[model samples]
Target: MKMFLCFFVLFILGFDDSSSQGNVNKAIKILTKQVKKLQESNKANFEATNMKIETLKNESQTNVKSLDEKITNQYETKVLKLENLIEQTNLTKMDVNSLFGEITNQTEFLLKAMDYKLGILKVGNAECSQYNILNEADRGISSGDGDNCDSTGLNTSPMWKGASWYRFLPPAGTILSQAAPGEDHCGTWLSGWCNATLPTVPGSTLDIEICFDYSGFQCWIAYDGKVTNCGTYFVYYLDNIRDCTVNLRYCGAN
Candidate 1:
């Protein structure tokens, strides 16, 4: 009877141990499934955040480009208006100065843009050098000395410490007549005498453009026989003068 009772207790204990082991394995599997779901959720959130940042970056770049284009168009419009104004009037010294004063208020970039748009010639590096005055026997006509600063067909005057002067031959068939006399302050004076004629029309008077900038930063233009203080350059029309020379004074140049 005692051996029978001991065998029955061992069987009961072995069955209970097996059942406990099975319950522990089921709990581990449930915990592993929860961990994988959490990992996937975190990965999705990270990718969404990166996508939002990239979208904002692209938008900011597009806005900057649009603003730049708008500003450029506005500047171009302003240049067109200025050209129209100049063409409509015979600008006096004060008128020209007033125009340039407004222009100078703009930034350097705008000035360069306006210059290019107008196709105006800014003295190049080759034309910036200084030159000496060549005295003439008579104030009637003076020829250009082949100096470092004087190019062929162009005469340069000594950039007096306070002024600048220049003379250039215009294209053929352009009409020109004498205007005001050159300022005495320009170191040397060259009279209006041009031997050059239009190749297209024999004996036709050649147009001579004389440019000068005074201490007051004034410039003028001569049409027919009248002198009108125009923009940044001076123009003087002359008749059958053998040689044309005018001393130029660089107004604000160092």
Candidate 2:
């Protein structure tokens, strides 16, 4: 009878152990399923984060390109504006030059002749360089030594520091006559004498031009703005005649 009781108790204990083990195994399977679900959720969130980062990177690159395009367009617009301004400035300069050239032509066309002797040109203490003298050798001209230009006016002297004197004529531009400081000159008793011709045509005008060199003492003459004659260099002696002035003669003598 004891052996039978012992076997029943042992069977009861074994079945209890087996049922506990089964419950433990079910609990473990449930916990494992929950862990796998959480892992999958984490993986999905990571992928989403990566996708957001990629989108932001692409957006940043596009923004940069757009900004660069805007800047380039602005720069090009400014450059075009500057070019237009430069063109306008050049046009203005050309117009000013044209106006100045016209005024110069009018002034030269209406130039008047001046006689340096008989106090005719000596209105004040002004120098001879102010007036362009017109003289003819056939007509009488008084002459003497230094500063003695004529007997009429003792102070009416010109810049005659050089040895040779030149007198130009109009129509066919030529040195009609030349003189030196002596009594034996072509014109008698003349500090400077020249046989000059007067323009016969009524509308013809005497035109003279001076082309100055960079050196202070040298200049050249041009007839009617044309350099046709050679050896017309005007050299200053004692640094006296350094200025470039037009000296033209049309009606020279009586």
Candidate 3:
């Protein structure tokens, strides 16, 4: 009976130890699986974060490229517009210069025509052989019948007509002397003789001096025999002979 009881006690202690070992093994297996699941979750989170960072970088690069292109296109458009403006300005300057050249040539020709008419007036007055002098001894002198007069008598004084004298005088003022060409004051040409064929140019004045504030100011001749101011120049037409009024058109801004 004592041997049986000892054997039964030993069997009970062995069974308890085996049961504890089995429980420990089962707990270890469950803990290992939980750890594996946690590791997989962490790895998935890291991959998602990396993908988000790569997407942000790509968006930033695309935005930078778009901005650069817009800026380049605006700069190019501005440069092209500036170039076109410069070309147009240059063309306008050339056209103004060409028109001014034609005007100068016409003014010179008109001045020459006036000089030729003056010489004829002086010679015709000198050849008159009969004259009537008041308050002189030889009062009534005749070229054909004269005693002690060597076939030639003093010439009669020539009378100037109103129309002929008006040509020589400045726009205002009386004629102080006989009408003559190439005779002017202040370097202007005067009309001494009137010819119907050579009518004065309409809207043009003679014997007027045109001065400028700058050196490159140009003057041109119109279809009429008058000088016209050209370019970006200030023109002053002075008439010292009289208080003459002038109506002028503005060529450029004052």
Give the TM-score of each candidate: 0.27, 0.33, 0.34
Task: Judging by lDDT against the true structure, name the best candidate.
Answer: 2
**Candidate 1 per-residue lDDT over residues 172-232, each given as its tens digit:** 1112212323433212332222222222211122344443322332234221221111122
Off by over 4 Å in 2: 1-19, 96-254
Ranking by TM-score: 3, 2, 1
lDDT of 1: 0.37
**Tens-digit lDDT string for candidate 3 (88-193):** 9899889878877777767754544344344322212211212221121221111111111111222211221111111111121221111222212211222211
Note the residue pairs that clash in candidate 2: 137-194
Rank candidates by lDDT, best first: 2, 1, 3
| For model 1, the run of ten residues with the poorest summed lDDT | 222-231
**C-alpha lDDT values of all predictions:** 0.37, 0.38, 0.34
